[model samples]
Target: MAARIILNPTAGNGKAQKLFELIQAHLPNDVEVVRTTGPGHATELARQVADQEDLTVVSLGGDGTHHEVINGLMPEGKTIFAVLPAGTGNDFVRTLGYPKSPRAMLDVALYGAERRIDVGRVNDEYFLTVSGVGFDAEVAGWVNQHEKKGNGTWIFLRGILRHLVHFQAEQMTIHVDGAFRSEPTFLLAAGNSPYYAGGMKICPEADPGDGLFHVVWVKDLSRLGVLPLLTRVFRGTHVQHPQVKTFQTEQLTVEGPPNMLVHADGEIVGHLPVTMTVIPAAIRVRTGRS
Candidate 1:
């Protein structure tokens, strides 16, 4: 019946640690808080408690931290999960309707309704939001390597612009639920829930509880077409573009051009030849939505 919070202290430039300290005064004594020492620590913490029935495991960082936590608790687990958005881009929480205030979010994390949601598995890791390869994956690498500050969307936009100027599209073959298409590729995002790289609705129609992935595929784009097309991603209107393709599938694979970087939930995990699979109602999470 107790709750354990696995928090990434360095997330948002020490913002998560500060928020955790402040919220301690308001949390019930049964709630235990554990600060992550480094990368992958949250996953280890989460795994230790994943099998504890009736327990709530709360993720108190951004998408990266949430990614680690969910990977630890999934495949099989009984612990209910919750999130307290504290990183530069809390993209996954956007789909959950979590409150913005730390105190209010704490309330929902501890006392909200529990709902089952789909999880996207890319290779071995699990992503709660969007996962992709090609140009966007390169953008994610650029954003992660440099210093991150302020609103994450602006930072990502800057990365996108910087990479777009010199980036070359790769040849890729994407297979969605058995159908295949091969061509010069811009980027393909497989989304379990909408909202990635802060607030860009890369796959606008994604629904976490629907047991499917809304995949968005962008065809090769000329340098001139990049600006106009990318600007609409925030509004998710880019899908209407003639070169863009969107579909729903339970599984898919991307092959071609080895060493092509792949990212899941904004973290660069591995290279190409990746398979994305959706696990229906894979994890239980606390949500504020009625």
Candidate 2:
């Protein structure tokens, strides 16, 4: 059994490096380890072993690292994936139900049950958590460019507050399954598993095994209404608001102003005019749950 740990030492503003110390003593004797040098390096590392059927590739950083790993493994990977949450937004690990403790997470990574989950594709990029556009995408781009001083949700909240006051909602055309409509949109998040921006359940009903995306769309909102609705998103109750709508689909499309930013798993992938589709049971993974 070959296993490799792809560690992103700079993730979580050095938090991953600190967490590595605790797990260092617990890794298997046979496990090989490698550290990522920069952005997209994790993907390059993971791709090196994606074709090994008997191998397990563990990601030991934040969601961004895991996002890179997933992109590397997708479409043809036979290796089992594992994650240890060591970053600001451990959203993917949250959805995986991994333990919060270092030793426990390591245990799950090394010996947990193997299962399969869905993968999401927006244009040519793949995502394991949520892919979003409009307001949230703009916020993601902003957060990526500045200093990351706080925890995941707090950081995202700060970015949201920075833009929410003056952010403008743009008109967008949406297509789900076979139906189509156009509306003023504040944001739209396509979720494979229900969580993003650390803990916000943007698409609360998304199920990775169900072969469908739980798409959440927030229609145009006034500044006052947007903030209140966003507050409820942490609890996933925002879906109940009149401005929000949820849909389940295997495929969808979003067409809007070309400048509208699009993000996959919190990392800005590109702009809008994207087609997102669910790839069912696309990758194998280790999880604490059966």
Candidate 3:
């Protein structure tokens, strides 16, 4: 079978392009490499390649690149999806137990087994990692707009601090599975996998193959109250905090401030009044041995 590599040249502050060169050398000579020029370009490339039966369409960038390719391929047909972690967060790959080296990722692309995984949908878009609203989504919007110099974790932390001073909690009415609640919330995340914001395990119990979402909601907290919990998230222990709540559901809906934005896999998608549903085993992906 052949491989179609869809690459986002600008991911990880142009580091993706450099890694692409190294990965290309390991790929077969006939493999097709398509470089994306702007937003939505990867989706188009993925759709074009997915039409070919028995081909593997590999995403060679960060989570946003993976997000677009998934949208383009679902409801999927014959193509198999694979990821090479050359993006800033690479959180989705982290959940799959892949190492963060280009050579290692490329080896998986070339030889890993195909496995089915769940996909999360918000409105009409499909996300492979996590989708949410509130403080984290707002921070994602800010980070996407402003260019930052340095590592991904430092840039996100800096953005969080900068936005925290002005970020406002929203009055939200949430419906999960069939249970409902109304509260003023600082953040709400529905995760298909456990990691986001570089390495933060926002929903530590999330599993993509289990046909459910691990949803986490943080009650309204003052800036200082939110600070200490930030470190705990990396260790997957933030759920123990009284201000945080976690549950599993096959579906969820949220009604919040109209101006509040929603983010899927770190790309700002739309505003709230959003619904997320779990599509069980919706796509096949190349993963390391379990």
Which residue pairs come into collision in candidate 3?
Answer: none
TM-score, each model? 0.97, 0.98, 0.96
Off by over 4 Å in 1: none
TM-score of candidate 2 on Cα atoms, chains taken together: 0.98
Sorted by TM-score (best first), the order is: 2, 1, 3
Report the lDDT tens digits of candidate 2 across residue range 1-290: 47999999998888888888998998888899899999999999998889998888999888889999988888775899998788877888876777878899899998899999999999999999999999999989887876367777889889999998779999999987678999999999999999998799899999888999999999999998888888888899999998888989999999999999999988999987999999999988899998
Question: After superposition, which runs of candidate 3 have C-alpha atoms over 4 Å from their true positions?
Answer: none
Q: State which candidate has the highest lDDT.
A: 2
Candidate 2 lowest-lDDT run of ten: 143-152
True-structure RMSD for candidate 2: 1.0
* Local lDDT at 129 for model 1: 93
- State in Å the error of residue 128, model 1: 0.3
Counting only residues 3 or more apart in sequence or on different chains, how many pairs clash (N, Cα, C under 3 Å) in candidate 2? Answer: 0
Residue-wise C-alpha lDDT for candidate 1, range 194-214, written one tens digit per residue: 889889889999999999999
Q: Residue 151, candidate 2: how far off, in angstroms?
A: 2.1
The lowest-lDDT stretch of 10 consecutive residues in candidate 1 is 144-153
Judging by lDDT, tell me the better candidate of 2 and 3.
Answer: 2
